[model samples]
Target: MERAEEGFGGGGILRQPPAVWATAGASVVAFMGIGLVDPILPSIARGLDATPSQVSLLFTSYFLITAVAMLVTGFVSSRIGGRRTLLAGLALVVVFAALAGTSDSVGQLVGFRAGWGLGNALFVSTSLAVIVGAAAGGSAAAILLYESALGLGMACGPLVGAVLGDASWRYPFFGTAALMAVGFLCIAVFLKDQPKPARKTSLLDPIRALSHGGLASAAAAAFFYNYAFFTVLAFTPFVLDMSPYRSGAVFFAWGVLLAVSSVLVAPRLQRRFGSLTVLGGSLVLLAADVVVLGYGSHTTAVVCTVLSGVFIGVNNTVFTELALGVSDAPRPVASAGYNFVRWFAAAAAPFFAPKIEEWSNVHMPFVVAGVAAALGALVVRVRRGSLVPAAVEPAPERVAPEGAEVLAG
Candidate 1:
């Protein structure tokens, strides 16, 4: 049998079935929703006459619902199957994105974004498993493909938002809706139903999966890491005080670096060192970078912001590998549980970063984010014993047929 790292049937990462490509394609559109509103944040604040904290609720609401909804993804997917679950998620995104475009107030927009988050939760949690199952290569290659889509979508989201949001804050929402509609059609046509688990998952299955010490450690560390990650994504646009086009350009660069490092750099680092070592070091570097971002001038801040993407990309791939491989649970269950813990940080950072600024100076938020990243590193250090090495495979053991087998023969 082929080694897991060598990939399935000796196929390369790029070679995959149509189902994998379709799932990955939709995943790109799904991830685009993450950064799609970034360039439009200031526009939304001004256009709706809202405070920065209120405007930041766009991220808060979306991720808050996503975090909570993760619990149900396995339950839903196991029963209805992957293809239907993906379609349901796409349908929700289409409806909510269009509704978000039509919102008259920050309140309405936040609510619509919350609805969008529910769809995002279902789609993202299921898409990873689908890609892994259908891809020609093994799990590592599938994850790289997913991360590449994340990078591309994140990169494109800002550019799209800048072009459309410059005219009006609402146009990006409508654009996302239309694009997801196309993604919906693609998945419908090209993706077949994924194989379901033998046992239907309960709503609490994800929660139970966290009982494994390694899974719990990975989730806890990722929770703090995501806090730092979203601080860059959801809060920095306001700190820069740039127009839609300029902000979009900067984040686009950041996203490009993120994509490249995730695909090209992370795997090499993993091979050279180990996943835990690489993750810990990357977290420390990210912490240092975020602190400098807090204290730096505009030029320094922009540079640090862009450079931080490299560390972020590495951390993302490593954490994902740990989450999926460290535990014995089903992939979907493990992913759901991992995301359920980490996405709360995605929600909390956006809401609290602006609030922190309101209560203190602007720099305090990044200071807090740096501390959070450091804590993530600390978690890795403390939990080192609990985490299983992701590359190690179990030894194969065979047993003879129970009833019909003869003695010694």
Candidate 2:
């Protein structure tokens, strides 16, 4: 599957090495656990005799920490190196997953989940740096690999959880832990550190990146985008509950389509239309999908669910890429900046969703998402932003694709 595609070897557009792709594979395996819980929340609640609220926090706490840590992980990865940081994060996943899955009490599960939060925080924060850092010289193939892993993780999460949950709710957690372990092993075997950059000794860096309008814009867009995503995700079920509509088949279709489109569908589209067009169109489609999903019932919901896969597939790669591409600050620092903004916004969103829902109804969250998405697109156009690859001019083709956009260069 190696592209063996040529790209810049120096000049900041150098090719990514094989080890980097292997590491992304490991990350995909480890990270896929994030979505597994969605399919079996009730199982967990019943198994533990916990309230629905407690079961719900499983998703909330993990994402809250993941988003918050994105800011710091970037900074930390640059200082420490991506491989080391990623390895440390993966190890923590194993420890925390075991603890949470095996816990005899609901409190123990919640506490261990918080521990999982720590590990995931490190993983989510560092992985992007590692991917972008791996692309230091620019291999678009590297970009594809990293994106594929993320997509793969997200796409398979629910289905994997569903399959494993059949055995037991705890079974899926154990399964994910085991997958993470294998990923750790692959990373151990394949990755090696490249020549290091001299660490900077300046306090002015922070003020510089945040001050960069591109960085701020990317972070803000990411925040609004995720806020909408999580808000809809957390509340969609409640909305479906309000109607006579059944959610199971719709969710399964959506989840399966999401997995398929990411792994099998988007690559061809990305190769053809290029990342920017795909990303821009995807964001537009996502908003449209949310609207249809919000207003419709049963069959329309299913159609919206399937189409939403395309939207997510296009974007799953792009936004994260933007977080890395928008700045030339020490990578970790830039990543930290983006993640801090993203997660902080995301963490606060759920707390505020009730107000949004109370102020309106289940439909309100989707309306908020649609507005954020539409406005974000407009902002990009006004600024002539380079956040998405299609929005910019061609760089050296080898580092990217033919007509692929250069980030800072």
Candidate 3:
């Protein structure tokens, strides 16, 4: 089997076709919705006269629906095709995000967020498959491109949120709606309809895909890792106790580190040490960072929180590569399966973190998150054999097409 090189020295990353760039542009806006609310969480609570825990349900509703909706994304995309799926997802996001801005109560906002999540599930899952199919270089290059969009969007989400949200919390939602509308238009204008897969995916296909040991192991590890990831994302705003602009600045810096490491640094580390080693070590460091963030002084916590982004960036790239390559199931089915398992943690972390703080103390949630990060590393170690050897090995000088390489195995 031809292995994918971990390096991007050939300018492959930048030499994408116009369709790829257009899709990537839309992807950036879609991912921005993930962190767009971080800078405004406190403001939302105050504006709506809700508590931290109540406000945290924004993540809960969004990710819970997202997790469930993952089961149906493959089914939808396979039938309607990628372009329509992408367009449908974008339209829903545009509508629901606008509605969320108009929400009068926390409950109303949560419901709108759930609608947004459903849309996100359709777009995000399909976007990966679309990029992999249409991208010029190979699956590795496509995955890196996707991560770039994720990192950039995550980095910018807070800055935009802070600026707009400082005026009113609702402004960020409206801003997201507007941005997504632009993305919708771009995709509508620029993207051609993708050819449907030979086999249409069923709702149960993703569940069945998890029966594969490698895909299952990857998903399990990602589930635990996501707990730690979302803790920083959803919980730290309250802990930092900074003004919206300051918190936005902090997370913006964090997102820059995340983007840099993901696009530029992770491949180098993977090339040197291999993907599994890089991932496991990064998780360990992330666990330590979480511990410090939980117990250290405020200034230390702030620094560690930003530093956690480096580890997160590396893990995101490696895990995504693994998820796409590990299973015999089609990319869409495997991705759906992987996302279905992992996003539950994304939903649970934000909901439970604040409540955990309220019940015990502010520090306990981070302690739990740290433990979860450690367990993620453990899962990777324990299941290393089941994962594809190619993922951990350096690429050969001559690489085959992604489809040919997978078939050769």
Candidate 4:
């Protein structure tokens, strides 16, 4: 048939063609390349004879830049178009990946990694826009797939890194670079950006649009979820390290299983229960997961760690979908804004959660997850009620997203 529809396909809730899926798959590989190096940073620093305080900058820089970059990505996507932004970003990652593999000092490594974060911001923001644009039905299913890819990448990172590190720590970074290049090639050759929007989106327009009710709530939830996740994920390896385990095997396994579960079932779950159900149930599971993991026993610790991934993956995907659908604002900007807050919270988690964990136990971070998830669920309940519609509600006057024509009653 003719290629896909103009401008990908539908609205935030819309779906794209098989080509979009392939592009998304490549995007995941690019991201996994980044993620693989992150989990082992502490060990890498030690191997390079660097200090822990200095090494921490690797994560801090990435998240800080990512948060700021996400805000800009939305506006840029509107201006330059999502396809170009994502493709360019993937290419940049290839360059940074090679640079990272060649670092002579912690300073150089940190700086190169910072550049990598910029590329990530572009990939995540535009890829999200593309997936949302490409969706055939609603953004929820597409968004879930994106999140699942993220989980898959995240899962693969540490497992691959651990194996590579066992051989030579440098191998991980080098292999990651190779992966990034491959991902770049895949996107450049296959994925195509749709035509730019007919209207020019002003610099301040997205900020003004997010002033709507559901949009703000969705943004808030995304921010909190990120904080919750980063807190646990950032700390877990340290926690596992403290145990008698030989190395970071536990955290690595946890990531692998989380990614597997998210990929294997997230779309089906979204199709069956809808975003609200997934969000609510996932929040509860997260609370339970954190509590169990926090207790810090042998069997309990491992089980809890794995559950954290499972709940967090499902929570993030569902929340992303909710953010896209619940908003009365436009889809692309809405997704970008929500991710902006999410990454910001993630950026901040390391700076803050340590003190809380010091005050209580490792479980304290999970407590935060429980609270954040609860707040997110409350927002969803108040805003969307449920993903399933028992009755019809009229579309609002605002129509910023592509699906609006279908929604406008």
The local distance difference test score of model 2 is: 0.60
Question: Which 10 consecutive residues of model 3 have the lowest summed lDDT?
Answer: 400-409
How far does residue 81 in candidate 1 sit from its true spot (Å)?
1.0
lDDT score of residue 332 within candidate 4: 61
Q: Order the candidates by TM-score, highest first.
A: 3, 1, 4, 2
Model 4: CA > 4 A from native: 1-22, 48-54, 81-83, 104-107, 128-151, 189-194, 242-278, 355-409
lDDT of 1 by residue, 1-409 (tens): 1232444345556788777888878777787788889888999999999998999999999998998998888789889998889999999999999999999999999999999999987887777667777777566566556656766887787888999998999999999999889889988988888888899988898999999999899899999999999999999999988999998898888888887676567767877897788999999999999999989999999999999889888888778777777788876677778888998999999999999999999999999999999999999999988875543432211100000000000
As a TM-score, model 1 comes out at 0.89
- Superposing all C-alpha atoms, what RMSD in Å does each candidate have to the true structure? 7.6, 6.1, 4.4, 6.9
Ten residues in sequence with the least summed lDDT for candidate 4: 400-409
Write down the worst ten-residue block by lDDT for model 2. 400-409
TM-score of each: 0.89, 0.74, 0.90, 0.75
Note the clash tally of each candidate: 0, 12, 0, 10
> Per-model C-alpha lDDT, please?
0.82, 0.60, 0.83, 0.61
Backbone clashes in candidate 4 total: 10
Model 2: per-residue Cα lDDT at residue 404: 16
lDDT digits (tens) for residues 1-409 of candidate 4:
0011222344432345765676667666755654565457667667778754466566667778876775677667667887788877777777776787788888887787778888877876567557656666555556545655666666666667777766666777778777767766766666676667777555565566567666677677666666667656665555555321233466556666656544444435766776567766776677667666767586777678766777765665455555566555566666656666667776676656555666776677667766776776666667664333311222211211322111000
Residue 303, model 3, lDDT: 98
Minimal lDDT window, size 10, model 1: 400-409
Whose TM-score is higher: candidate 1's or candidate 2's? 1
Candidate 1 residue-wise lDDT at 360: 97
Give the lDDT of residue 251 in candidate 3.
Answer: 89
Instruction: Give the winner by lDDT: 1 or 4.
Output: 1
